[model samples]
Target: AFVAALIAGEKAAFHEWEAAPYFEGCLPVEVMAERGPETLRHGPLKPFGLTDPHAPERKPYAVVQLRQDNKLGTLFNMVGFQTKLKHGEQLRVFRTIPGLQHAEFARLGGVHRNTFLNSPKLLDASLRLAAMPRLRFSGQITGCEGYVESAAIGLLAGRFAAAERLGEPIALPPATTAHGALLNHITGGHVDAIEAGPRSFQPMNVNFGLFPPLAEGIRRAGAARTLAKKQALSARALGDLEIWIGRHPAAAAE
Candidate 1:
C-alpha cells in the first residue's frame, strides 16, 4: 500500500482488509507459483517483468534467483521460497539451478500473519498504541510477542501510562531490559522511524537470541539454559519496573 501510493503520488492509508486461514500455498501470493509455471507467470509473475521486451539486455521467462545465504560462498537457495513441503521435493526442484545443485540450506523460510497498530503516528510515547492512551494495544498487535517479552512491554506501558494518570511525566526503560529492546525495535532500530523500504519494518519477537552478546569477557555470563537466561532477566526487570510503577500507581493499575 505504501509503494502503491508512492507510484500514484498521493498519501494513502490502506491495510490488509481481510486475511483468512493459512496454508503452504496461501501464506503469501508468491508462495503458490513455485508449484508450476502456468500457475506462476500468470499469477505472481504476471506483468511484473513487463519492461520493454524489445530491449536485448532484458530476458526472463520467469525469474527466481538466490543470493548467498552468508558472507561465505558455500550456500544459495530460492528467493521468497518458504514451504513445509517434503525435503525430496525441495531438493529436486531447487537443485535444478546452475550453481546450487549441492548447496546446503541453513534454514528454509516460512511466514505468519502479524497484526500491528501503526504506532509511530498513532500512539503517545507511553506505548499505548492508540489515539487515546486509555486504550492500549499489546502482544502481537503491539508488535511484541513471547512469554516474558510481552509482559515486559506491559510492565513498562502499564507503569509509564500509570505515571501519566498520577500526573508524573512518563519514564522510559533503560536500554538494558528485554522490555527496552522490544520498545526500541518498535520505535527505531533500523532506518529513520518514518522512512519507507518493502524490507523495512518486519515484525520482531523477543528472546535472548536477539540480544547482542556481551563483549567476550566483559562480564561473567549467567546460566547456559536459554529459557533460564530469559527468566533471570525477567526477574531483574520486574524489580526495576516495580519502582517505576510505584511512581505512577494509577497507570500501572490500569
Candidate 2:
C-alpha cells in the first residue's frame, strides 16, 4: 500500500516550473518507488536494525523511522522522507503508514536544486584549484555528497590550507579510510565519457565500494562473505586512519 501510494503521489506531485535533476545520492522517495515495488524495501524502508517488540519473530515488510527534531523529543522528523508531493497528497499518502494514522506533520516536504562543481576536473588532490592554487574548494560543492562527507572534505581542505600557510607538508588521509575514499572520489575518481557534452562526474556518498578491495587470500566466499568483507574493510580503515593521525599530530589536535 505504501509503495503504491508513493508511485501514485509521484505522478500527482507539483514540480517547479524548471525542476532540477535529482541528485543520485538524495533521491525522492516517490522516484525510488517508481523504479520497482521492492526498491523502497531495500532502500529507505529497509528494516536493518529495528525490530517490532510485540512480534519479535516476524520481520517487517518496511519501516518508517522518525528522528527526534526537538530538545524535548516532542517533535520528530521523518528520516529519508524527502518529497515534492503536494500537501494534501503528502497527508493522504503518509497516513497509510501503520503507526502514523493520526500523526501531525510539522512541515511538508519540498524539493530544492543542489549545485555542485566538477571537482575531479577542476581541483587537485588537496582540493586546491588547478588554475588558482590559492583558492580551495570543499563540501558538496566539491561533489562529495551528504553532510558527513561535506564536513570531512571541509576538514581536509582547512588542514591543507593551514599547512601551506605555516610552511608544513600536507599529508593526505590514507585511501582506505572513509575520509580518504571520499576525498579521492572528489579529486580524481570518476572516469570521463568519450563523447564530450557535459562532464559525467556525479556527487557520491562514501560506501565500501569506494574502498580498495580486500586481498584475495584475506577474503572468503560464502553467504557471509559480504558481511565479512565489510568488517575487514572497516578494520583496515580504522587502522589506516589511526596511522594517518599519528603521522599528523597537528592535524589530529585540530
Candidate 3:
C-alpha cells in the first residue's frame, strides 16, 4: 500500500522542476518505489527484527522506525524517509503507513543535491590536485560518500601533507583495509569507458565490491561460501591493516 501510494502520488508531488539525479545511497522514497515493489521492502522498510505485540504470530510485511529527534521526546524522526514529494502529497501518502494515521509531523522531508568532484580525474593518491599540487582536496567534495569516508580521506590528506612538510615519506594503507580501499576508489579505482567523452566518476560509499577479489578462490557453493568469503576478507583486511599500522607508527599514534 505504501509503495502504491508513492507511485500514485508521484504525479502530483514530483514534477519537471524537481527532476535531478539523486545519490544512490540516499534515494528518495518515491524514486525507490518506481524501481520495484520490493525495493523499499528490502532497502529502507526491511522488517528484519521486529514483532507486532497485538498479533505476535503474524509477521509484518514492512516496518517504519521513528527515531527520537529531541531531548523532550515529543518529536520523532522517520528513519530513511527522505523524499522529494510535495508537502501536501507527502502528508497524504505518508499517512498510509500503519500507526501514522493520526500522527502530527513537526517537519516534512525533502531532498537536496550533493556536490562532489571527479577525484579520480583531478586528485593524486595523496589527494593532491594533479594539475596544481599545492591544493589538496578531501571529504565529500573529493567524491567519497558518507561521514566516515570523508573523515578518513581528511585524515589521510592531513597525514600526507604533514609528511611532505616534515620531509618524511607519505605511507599509504594497504588496499585490503577499508581506508585503503576507499582511498584507492577516490584516487584511481574508476575506469573510463572507451566511448566516453567525460569520465563517469561518481561519489561512492565503501563497500565490499570496492575491495579486490580474494587471493584464493572459495571452492564451496551457496550461502556457506558467501559467509566464508566475507569472514576471510574481514580477517585478511584486519591483518593487513595491523601490518600497515605497525609500519607507520606516527600515523598509528594519531
Task: Write down the lDDT of every candidate, Cα atoms only.
Answer: 0.55, 0.85, 0.86
> Using Cα atoms with residue i matched to residue i, what is each candidate's TM-score against the true structure?
0.39, 0.85, 0.89
Residue-wise C-alpha lDDT for candidate 3, range 41-153, written one tens digit per residue: 88889997788899989998888878998899999999888887778888899998889989897899987777887788888999999999999988989998999989999
Best by TM-score: 3
**Superior by lDDT: candidate 1 or candidate 2:** 2
Which scores greater on TM-score, model 1 or model 3? 3
As for TM-score, the candidate ahead, 2 or 3, is 3
Per-residue lDDT for 8-64 in model 2, tens only? 774444547646677876788898888999888788888877677998888888887
Give model 2's TM-score versus the native structure.
0.85
Residue-by-residue lDDT tens digits, candidate 1, 1-254? 21122123211222476343443323333345434435555543344555655885676555555567667876765555554444454555555545667767676544555566655556655676465657765555665655566677677777776777899877686445566667777655443345363333445676565544433332334455555556656665665567554765775566
How close is each model in CA RMSD to the real structure? 16.7, 3.9, 3.5
Clash count per candidate: 2, 0, 0
Candidate 2: count the clashes: 0
